[model samples]
Target: MVATQQTAGLSTSGRAVQAVALLLGFYLLAAAIVLGLLGLDLALYLGSDHLRPALFKIWALTAVVIYPVLRVVFLTRRPKGGESGGLLVGRAEQPALWARVDRLAERTGVRGPAEIRLTAEVNAAVREDTRLLGLIPGKRHLEIGVPLLIGLTEAELDAVLAHEFGHYSNQDVRLAGITVAGRTAIVHTIGTLHERADRQQAEDAAELRAEAEDRLARGKQPKDRSAGDGGVQRVLARLFTRYARLYFRVSESVGRRQEYAADRAAAEIAGRDATASALRKIPTLVAAQNFYLGAYATLGWDAGLLPAPGQVYGGFAKLLADPGRRAELAAMGLALPEREADPYDSHPPIAQRVAAIEALPADGRGTEGAGPALDVLHEPERTLAELEAVTLVPEAATKRRVDWPELVAESHLAHAREAAQPILRALTGSGLPGTVDALLDAVDRGEGRQLAERLPRSAAATAATGRAAREFLRPALRAGTARLVVLALAESGLARWELSWSAAPALVLPEGMAETFDAALDAVVADTPDTAPLRSLLVAAGLAPVAG
Candidate 1:
């Protein structure tokens, strides 16, 4: 790690600034230590004093007891876990990937990381796990975004990997890890303070409510204060807020410098052209991944019991292959916030990164002999299945993978079921006829806006009725028939609504809406003395009356 060694033996000015930052961190630590000691001394002195002094000593003892506890809590609180944004791939699972990473690390003059992880994010990085406020270095891991792997050729992927490895080469791995720990500590402390403030506020509100109830019982007025932070919590919260802002400002400034240096190291290894393209493609691919995920959520959710990564990727690739969508996504990527310099941002804007890469000496290299980067994985299908198993909806775990056309049909069927449930529930009671009459009268009175607002907003029913009201209700209301109105609602989107030969209504809730309706129905049936009466009433009405 020649670059890391060079950074270590930095010039006097660089060394001075680094030393100042380190000293400031040490100063905070020393001040906490001094406060603890002072409180300890005061506690010891007050223990031997009279009652008046002992009362004051109690406050000192409180400080002495709480400081160490808070300090330890701040030091030991787990960082919000890393993004489980993708699946993990061990050496045994992806030998070729690991081998390539080894070659890149050796070329980049950085030690091989402890592990490599794959994610669905559009970025790659080398991160060292830090614990105990950075007193201990846990394992270092390399995380590569799967979308980036899919988008980039082998040469481009190599350049991105080299860029991450560059951080390790310059010992930014360790420096960044420690600073990240400090940032986490600051955030955790602030959160804890706010949480305490929240609890106090809640208790105060409850007490005030109780007092108001008592006053009302006695025929008296109640007084309440505006909600806000109170007592010592307010001061501590404000202090931490200011400190967090300052800490991030200073840290991100240094962090940006590290990014630039790492960029330079990456260029030195993988060539400027490759690095520049890789950086530019990152945001674009990120936008594409978002679109891809939306597609999965909509059309691919219930495909089959075993959807593989390749199938998922294939679906996404088809999405990207659309000329119209590709252009829209490319525009979105360009629109992402980055052009303006944000003082707290760790990486500079993409334009600035590109400029920096351009300023470097050009190496006459091309992306020759490059292939698809994802080919390095051993069993992509199985890997994809495993990843989906953990991340997909529970029902999806048992679904069998289906082709794209089948997926689309399933999605439509699911949506139809969701849309119809609330309508059927509303129809169940005797009051449904009266409700329908009022709705028709409202439509005749041109009170569509008011009627729309008053419609049941249960997820499936709301969407269904909304569509029907907008597109079909006017015609049905003009016909002045309950059956026609119901028919129009079904046609427009309320879902298939009809009567069975048994002369009772048969309704299917939209695929996902049944659970929601079931929960609501549970509450109604729970306290009823005889659900049988309700069931008979529903049967007599030809549709069960249930509150939406």
Candidate 2:
């Protein structure tokens, strides 16, 4: 494998030094070529007599490209951006976690992290603060995601951490800053110049269109030839794109090899079986984590509500640990991964990584069976919640906090209240008051079909007319009617939304109303007029009786 060959020939420090020299020299080389063009332009100016005026135009054109290339060489995150936003903690607060990391770093043959931080992502990474195009390493940082702590066991966590530490041990992190910054500069430069070229082209086209319009009005034929501003910058963008592709092809090819080397190191440190299991289970954990955040954690997020303090991120562990969820996640993890190999992808497919890890000859390292990874932290719930508050969402600080139950119920009600808006609009649009009573009144008056036809329904229903249209709209009408009735009931204390982990928010009806409620909704929107029974139910709930 290319990975094996790369690591075998060069020492870790040698690879790092070579990468730094290669990328930094590549940037300098580009700068020199640009200077060469200007130098030749000066030579033509000083030595030639006939091409003197044309050189002025050449200078003007070359000046446009020189600044962007030089700017990329100098600016463009020379220090490779500041430390990412996260909850930074030290050994004093989490000594047990620190000890584990220090030992791993020692065994992995690298200096231990200068800082450990927690983030909200479902991933972990190690980065360095480097100087002079990543030639000298400064402070190092390791960021661990809380979900990994919550979902993985100690052995799997060890494999994941070791994989990231392997990047350092192989010196992958050292030149990573320089290579990433270079590629970033090229991409930004291309995007910036192309944007200006597009705008200029648009403005020139607009001017030409206006001239043509004026000529047409004056009873003259429009000119066929275009006399517009040339896209010199567009041509420059294409050149940069060609060069940038070469940089990516070189750096990312090395990056993919580094991933293989890291996976091998992780397998050696934490056992091949544990490493492979972690690789497969990670995707499932990420899926479950995203689902938990969307479905359960942020149920009341948009309504300016969040779970009670220390419960937001901590609650995900409870969901993952639930007896019902464990079986489902286990089943999900067994499914085979289907991913196409992309040449530009920095990491190989999970299947490939697992196969490579398993191919190694038997090593004595084995899973520790050390229980949950969360045991690494002292009071993990507090740590998770603290990270959630600072880094999870920007608007979290201003949101009102409530227990999970109230948050779930209130959020559904808030959604229900919002969904009611369109139904009310449909009612008011059809010349009826936006109320369930008015809808029922129209049905009793034998014009329910006409009213249903007018309001916008589903695509299948909208395509029909006459009796078929009414039939198509029947289910939707019943559902919409139930929403209006439920909102009224919820407001009047006859209905409420209950939290359901396995399903959507279940609307709980009052006692003695559960069995006939669905049929009553159907009857109200049926072909035949049947208001007596349905209206009777609402009247008993203290709604006024229909007047003659």
Candidate 3:
């Protein structure tokens, strides 16, 4: 009833605009077809010279151009075929997920998507792909972002799925697909123009470069200039962009209204608070996943060990372990600009959506079996690992799971070997321990700054037993070489790597090692109050602080 009321309440003016937008989309394609037919008719008429010879020739040329463009634009392609982004989660492969979708659709009073798929994005959406100009039902697909699945609670996920279904309920999916096609057509035409212009520009630039080289050989000054789109191309691009913008101005309002209606429908079916909570968490969840990826890289973990789909929640949990950090991230997500929405923005601000959702009465309509949403898929870990191997991790890296300690240890040893080279060159059989000691003493005496500079940060730090030898290192290396230095440091007991539930890796110091090192470093740099030397020393020692 809420959905029906919302649809019925759409202003007459808005309905008229929607009609206009749909008509506009259809007319563009219809005009192309009509033009093609007119061109064909003109071509046949021209053979008889029924009109003046000059006029016939002009019509013939116009027809020749129009027919081909029309064929390319409409006749050669079906709107239904193309790679829509995401991994298709078929009913056979993920029956539970399909079942859940069907149940939610029934409750929401709408047909579910024709297909379901998984994505690596941070949000879920419903989309339609077809060529019937919004008149014929197209293949509607539901894309559920894996991160969202992992981060949101089961109820929240259901609300999100329901919200997407609401769009289908209102027939917005078909309308959006038509608008997308309209936009694509305009973009395609403009792109062709730009491509031609760019080709001409590139040729012009090559000629200019050659001319300048010849002028230089002849000892003459070459004129300075730039190559750009030809005037015709520039005009055409501008016209298309402007025309599309105008059409979107009318159409975008329709889109935004549809979104609001969908939201209302979703709130009615899925419970208002569930939908609101889902909206609230989306930004933070996305940021948390981003943090997980960054931390994985910073920790020097093998990319092949991309967090399993199930582990995404673990990563997000680890990231927000600190209350302050959690609040900070939440604040960042909520901090939208205090300005009106961009005319082109397809979605409204999160704050606005949440506020609206909050206004709806609670329905208390959660499904009984809404346990951990991950259970809907079979062998999620294997599925995620496979996705990672294909999309992110190199095939070679996929075979092994290298944790943080191994990564750090590997980085340390590699750097130690490189750092030893120059010291060995200078000391000539002084032995590794003695040579390293001498370098540290020189650093203490401010005499071996350059020598310290030559060595890795892990190798440069003076090694000492007990608590006095506290140090940190950040490998200034990439890929495989990066982890060797950390490994060496761990092996030598100069620093210990702490592998934990946290996404960020850290160095585990013996009781008070951090304090001892901090105090010693503070004393060493106290006079000048400059820590660059200490920082460099730590890097040389293989104990640079890992970035979180």
Candidate 4:
């Protein structure tokens, strides 16, 4: 009877694991096949019959090697065997919080005790060790991060903890960790390969340019160069770019799906309502985590630990503020309470997950449908308003003004100094600042058009100065309704001009607005004859004009 029961339990667990594994495996395989075909096409175009074959072989080998390595890495990384030394735990001043965790564990019948830890960001996870490697034979331990502990209410916290314990009850944590780790490792490897390819291409281009210069100096015509070189370069660049994009997409999809499986496991082990509440709280947590990560990066703590804060904030804020981004976020089901399994995404989109939870039957037992609605964790109105208040402005409109001739001279000097050190060593074996400066000046004049066209984007630090200027001029502009008064700033090299009211308040001009503004500015500038005269008159009258 004992042997029969053990066999039946094993069969049940295998079936559950197989069902999820097959679905996710099929999705990943299809993506890999598509990427392989594209990579093959690229290789063939570059005239690398041997290289193409080798690339495919390596790709296949990585897929095999990466999968197992990722599994092992993830499984081993978690806080297991009561390893709480590295984590910040037991630092909470609230005695009630510890009492709550103990009570919940008892109510859920968890064999392992849950340890609470704190982090600056808002996130919580139930970490455990199941001794899959057999060193401790079924010994289990649970750990909870502080961010989630402090962020959620008592009931919400309980629900989250229960959902984590659900992983233990369902025995899904072991497999979940492996899958998450494997996917991360594979994506990281692909990114590294793409970067290496880019570096190689850059080196090749530099070498080609040097060779071409030598040939030209020796009186060889451009037509004397070998055919197909341009085509080969273009093909190589295109192939690498395509491969990089596709690889990232595949990795993102895998990550999305993995999240869904974890969520499903949580719902099965705890309750549907608890899972739904946890999902709802994620966006706020993500925002807070991003803020802290940005703070660290700005202080130059570690570049590898976070994305550039400005870029991350700008991108996310744009997504949140724009109507289109709002719609997209909504479509992802950010406000919903159901879950839908997506084969393409590793995690089901938030909307789908919410739906899945809502669909569960109210019988208080696992069934084919979602459960009853839990209390919604609505964000404070003030918080939502604050997010809405953040804005993005055009870069060109807010750049600082500089004298074009002086700026060009400085750039020339810098470039000449850079080139002089190498040339001096190769020739006279001594660096001359005067000679370097002269050379740089000549190069700058020659490359003036190119530099002008690639003008720097507006600096965020300069926006405040620009805004002060706009505020000073606002009353004057509003005085006359005959024509819309727009302020124009000259480009660094005087190649072109851009207009703005203030960076934040983008002045939307009607059709033919530029022509009208140009005519007006031309008349004013023509009368004044110099930008300094006009700027002085405006500033003397309390208007602050910012120029680049």
Best by lDDT, which number?
2
Candidate 3 displacement at residue 15 in angstroms: 5.9
Deviation in Å, model 2, residue 127 alpha carbon: 1.5
**Predicted structure with the largest TM-score when compared to the true one:** 2
lDDT by residue (1-548, candidate 4, tens digit) is 99987875685356445544543553455356556655765666576645656667756754554433333222224323345422333424335555655665666656545455433234455554544321122544555433344334444555566666655544445544444443444444344444545665677677767788887899985434332333322433344345435544554454454455446655655567656766676665465446433432122222112222232222233324446534544454355554555444545667776666767765364332232111121222222222223322234223332332332333333333443333333222222222322222322344212221222223532253554643433232222211212211111221122211111212233334444444443333232222233333334433344321
**lDDT tens digits by residue: candidate 2, 1-548:** 99876766565556556556656665676678687888988888888767767788888878876766665545544343777887888899899899999988988889989999988778999998877767688889999988888888888888999999999977778778777877777777778668767887888888889999999999999888574443766776777788777777767777888999899888888888788778888889899989998888888988999988877888888788777788888888777486876666678887788788878887755647558988999878788777876886677889998987798778878887887776677778877787778878877888676665665677877887777876887776677778888777777767788876656668887766777787788788776858677676777766564343
Q: Give candidate 2 misplaced runs (Cα > 4 Å).
A: 1-29, 32-48, 51-59, 64-79, 198-230, 361-367, 428-433, 457-476, 511-518, 536-548
CA-lDDT, candidates in order: 0.61, 0.79, 0.60, 0.42
Q: Could you give the candidate ranking by lDDT, starting with the highest?
A: 2, 1, 3, 4
What does candidate 3's lDDT look like per residue over 134-240, in tens digits? 65676678888877766666777888888888888777776676666666666666666566567778888898999999999999998897776654455545655
C-alpha lDDT of residue 123 in model 2: 92
Give the runs in model 1 whose Cα sits over 4 Å from its true position. Answer: 1-8, 11-92, 129-139, 227-230, 298-314, 330-338, 366-370, 390-400, 421-548
Candidate 1 per-residue lDDT over residues 1-548, each given as its tens digit: 99866656573236335534653664475366457767776776666655576656666756754564355344545667574556777888899999999999999887788887776567888887766444356688888876776777777888899888887766676666556756766677667767777787888778888888999899988875555554456556666677678777777777788788888887888888888777877888876777666655345454342324456654455555567766776676455555786788888887888788978877886564277776777886666556555555567656666655445544545555454444334433324443343433333445543433343544544465655544443322222223333433344455453322122224543444444433432322232212233233233434434232
Model 3: per-residue Cα lDDT at residue 174: 67
Task: RMSD for all candidates, in order, please.
Answer: 11.3, 4.2, 9.1, 16.6
Models 1 onward score TM values of 0.69, 0.85, 0.70, 0.42
Worst 10 contiguous positions by lDDT, candidate 4 = 481-490
